[model samples]
Target chain A: MSESDRQGGEPEPEPERTSTGEYVLGGLGGLLVLLLLGFLIYQAAVVRDTGPELSVTVTGVETAGNGWSVHYRIANTGGQTAVQVQVTGVLSRDGTEVEESSATVDYVPPGSRRSGALLFSEDPGSGDLQVRPSGYSLP
Target chain B: MSATTDTEHLATGVGRAVGGALLFALPLFMTMEVWRLGHTVERYRLALLVLATVVLVIGLAHYFGAGPGGVSRAGYLADAGVALVVALLTASVVLVVLAVIDPVQDRQSALSVVVIEILPAAIGASYARSQLGAGSRRPQAPRYGHEVFLMAAGAVVFAANIAPTEEVVLLAAKLGERNAAVLVVLSLVLMHGFVYWVGFGGQEEATGFLRSFRNLTVVGYVAAFAVSAFLLWTFGRFDGVGLPVVVGQTVVLALPASVGAAAARLIL
Candidate 1:
């Protein structure tokens, strides 16, 4: 070993930069901000159709709380926003409305689809289920 | 620059930041679009918005008051970060309690939703000193450009609360072409009146009515429209919508935006 290694004054240790509290707080804050940003970047992108057309498509019939329920999806095909959207499902037999059930979707934005369940006293699958958009108000 | 992490500094400042978040950002929390934004906002875009908000919050802290005096850059950034965290936490808690964020809400989307909210939510945190302190308003005649910027900021805040939902589009749809035209004129007149006639905050400083209209009111309205239009585009209000619809929505949004601009001149 060199003679300097044996000497006590070989090197001086640097002063400790305090602010450990700030370091800890800043570290914690940075971690949270990054984590939040990471989650935002990782999430899936939601792409809805563009426009103001409201179209109702019946997807399935399910047994709900009562006799039966018609499950349907409402899509806004037009280019504007429709508010207070009301959908009607009419069970028809020989051109007569056997059972009518109506469901409401509070809002339906253009290119977005929302679903609702229309409960009917009669079996939804038993008759020709005709679902139609009843009414909607412009936002 | 809230550069110092002293115990007292943390306590009082944090409490005030929380209060600011609640007072200023509550409307955003209740807005349907903001809640729905959790589901609809693109992930990457939300990240960008959050990042931008971070920079903006830091700038606000630097300009307004990050620390008691002479805050460094680190302090400004750190203070903004803390304020953002507080705002985000507050929003999440309130939303969860309100059932706006249900168990079924996608965690990623919920995070994104809450993150995008930081845009306006962070305002309360960074502006707490000016908003809450008694007799502390130091209103000065801002430069013309700064005046326009304040209007834009106010407009953006108001627009953020309105544009995300389907209300603007719905309103556009409901209004007949003639009705929409009338609304446009009405908006312009109101914007002019708010500053010139109403004598709110900044309006009191204007010269004559015509000159004020030309120099301040007219300029302010145009800036509000421009800001509102930009917000409308960002909010997808123009997606698949025609020019007429766009104009209608713009008018609807501009009214609030102009009011915000006037308020900025008065308040900020």
Candidate 2:
């Protein structure tokens, strides 16, 4: 039989050989890539589960006679439950600090939200009312 | 030419493809996490849905035309481009339809917007890295390595961007527009640049000096965070100063972590 017929048609071309450097480098690179992926996945887990550290969202604020009444919706956005959540409301007029009032809540649970009020007497002229969530100032 | 050669070639190809896919998945997951954390669930859900759709379309393309030879550079780019265009068009149509139907601002819509805005960018960046090193010899090829490097870089960026501690402090300080902008830009550039340099430096250099330098960077970052916190605290004492400590801490951690990762990538 002819060589071509014996080989069953034309012989396939030889595949390109990969170099040693390429193989070694590629393998190392692949391993590093895997390690990086593992690290990232771990990082993502950390970011996701790291419970409510401290986060406060202001819902509304208003003014009442004789003093300024401020309403705040506070939540312990961190993972751990906070014992005391203190929120301080500083009334400012024309970029100047006029009066400040604060209120403290007993316990704030992670993922749970609550509202509180703080009143300041000294009139903060016409300006924006600013509320700050201070750390858990214990009793 | 020979059966053995064909088998070896096929094996290497499969290995690289699997490695690439896994590498790709890492950033995608992290990106999802960032979206989930930075925004509401509805937003995250919407983004994920869109992303899934994009992936499906790409999958379909591969199933039919590409046929598992592993996506070529052009094929990957084309798929990504088409997916992006479809996503944008779908989003615009949805927005218009919603607007016409009396404004759907439910969790879904909000989430959709956030997802549309974020995921595309993340996916696009990932695709770019993949295409850059499509057929290299290395098992981990520069492209895939770069992708991992980018993900690590991204983690740092995400951490820095949402740095609650710095944000809270800056806001409390009542930093003027210029100062605020400057602070953000500087932090991002310096921190990200540090990371990129370390990453690009390669493993050996990264391990030698960069590893030891990391402690110094961390210490410096902590000190910087403390100083920022102190400034906020003192300013608060005077009035008109409300510090956001959480934001500041986030920023501090992101920079160092990003830089450290880059350094590790470069040297070790």
lDDT leader: 1
Indicate the docking level reached by candidate 1.
Answer: incorrect
Clashes of each: 12, 35
Q: TM-score, each model?
A: 0.63, 0.26
Candidate 2 per-residue C-alpha lDDT over B139-223 given as tens digits, one digit per residue, 9 for 90 to 100: 2333433434333433432332233233444453455656544664565455445643444444222344564345333333443
What is candidate 1's CA lDDT for residue B20?
A: 79
Quick one: best TM-score, which candidate?
1
Off by over 4 Å in 1: A1-31, A42-139, B1-5, B103-105, B132-141, B176-185, B201-204, B207-216
